[model samples]
Target: MKPAVGAIRRASIYAVVSYGGLVLINNSGLQLPSMWIAYLPMFIGVYVFTQWVDRKF
Candidate 1:
């Protein structure tokens, strides 16, 4: 239950960062497709990686 709760929290943070990254990229003149293809995945991947690291440590 505790690990589940922590996962939910980390996922929420990832959502925020992913959305924020998309917004920033779009505003910076990147096309929607490109933004999703590039920046969004990186942000999500990093977030997941960090969560894995957290659990490991």
Candidate 2:
């Protein structure tokens, strides 16, 4: 149950980042390159960082 809760928390964070990025691209006036491209590195970085942190602690 404790580990499940942590998994839920991490999943929520990922969802927020994904949807928030999409919303920003839709609402923001500033022109930019593909929004998904910008977001990919961030998502991957966060995932990798989380794995590293979990292993360390």
State which candidate has the highest lDDT.
1
Per residue, candidate 2 scores C-alpha lDDT tens digits across 32-56 of 6676666677668767766665555
Task: Report model 1's TM-score to 2 decimal places.
Answer: 0.58
Please, what is the TM-score per model?
A: 0.58, 0.49
The count of backbone overlaps in candidate 2 is 0
Clashing pairs in model 1, backbone N/Cα/C closer than 3 A:
none
Top candidate (TM-score): 1
lDDT of 1 by residue, 1-57 (tens): 988978887777667766776677667875554445777577867687667756764
Worst 10 residues of 1 by lDDT: 31-40
Q: Candidate 2 at 20: error in angstroms?
A: 1.1
The local lDDT score (0 to 100) that residue 53 gets in candidate 2 is 58
